[model samples]
Target: MATSKFLFGLLLLLILVEMNIIEQPWMPGVEAIDCSGKCNYRCSKSGRPKMCIRACNTCCKRCQCVPSGTSGNKDECTCYANMKTHNGRPKCP
Candidate 1:
């Protein structure tokens, strides 16, 4: 009986450890996207660098950059970087 109880306790401990590993959560945050096309065009025509800056800021807040030359459309921006969770907190890199 004692041996059976010991085995059961060990099994329970193993199960708890597994649960902790599986229950790890993912965190989300702002991601940056490429606004090169829009930025260049607007900056050229309007003579306003601020427009590009604002668009970049907005893109950074909403999306993440993928690999360059992978963008499907000229209008579709790519992410330059990602803001993600590290150690239960959001970090931008």
Candidate 2:
């Protein structure tokens, strides 16, 4: 009975580990995307550089893409384009 319980516990632990592995968004061996560089380019023309970089980074991470050019190309990334501030203003640069 004790041996059976031990085996069952081991099986449960393995199943949980496998589930965690499957649920992860990032996969091993895939190159990490450069969110900082893209966000920098996206926010370059803004008067508020810090604020723009901060917002752009958040949007880039969530959208996994940044619109091309320094400004007014939000249409390139639907997720980035759709994010809004508390007062309904656009979020990304």
Candidate 3:
């Protein structure tokens, strides 16, 4: 019984270590920022705030970062830089 408990504890430790070593897809670069807040911050400067939030939220959810200003700074997040709408329009604000 004691040997079984020891093996279970060892397995649990391995899992914890593995989790610490892996990086999350949503937080590729910068420290994780709340997508909703990022979207709101950028959209505030937009002429079309509602549309900007909608678009920014989509990109932020995927890329986990919002570009600076009202438009065009996609280099910060490669995923956001590459995104496109169904109509081929830029997807991120």
Name the best candidate (by TM-score). 2
The clash tally of candidate 2 reads 0
lDDT of 3 by residue, 22-50 (tens): 55454465465698887898888788899
Candidate 1 lDDT, tens digit per residue, 44-81? 44345665455444554455432223223423433333
* Whole-model lDDT values for every prediction: 0.45, 0.83, 0.80
Tens digits of per-residue lDDT for model 2, 26-57? 55544446999988887777899999999989
Judged by whole-model lDDT over C-alpha atoms, candidate 3 comes out at 0.80
Which rank order by lDDT, best down to worst? Answer: 2, 3, 1
- Candidate 3 Cα misplacement greater than 4 A, ranges: 1-32
Residue 8 displacement (Å), model 1: 36
Residue pairs with colliding backbones in model 3 are none
Report RMSD (Å) for each prediction in the order shown: 13.9, 6.1, 5.9
Q: In model 2, state the lDDT of residue 27.
A: 55
Better of 1 and 3 by TM-score: 3
Candidate 2 has a TM-score of 0.66
The deviation in Å at residue 17 for candidate 2 is 10
Candidate 1 stretches with Cα past 4 Å from truth are 1-46, 66-93
* Candidate 2 residue-wise lDDT at 59: 87
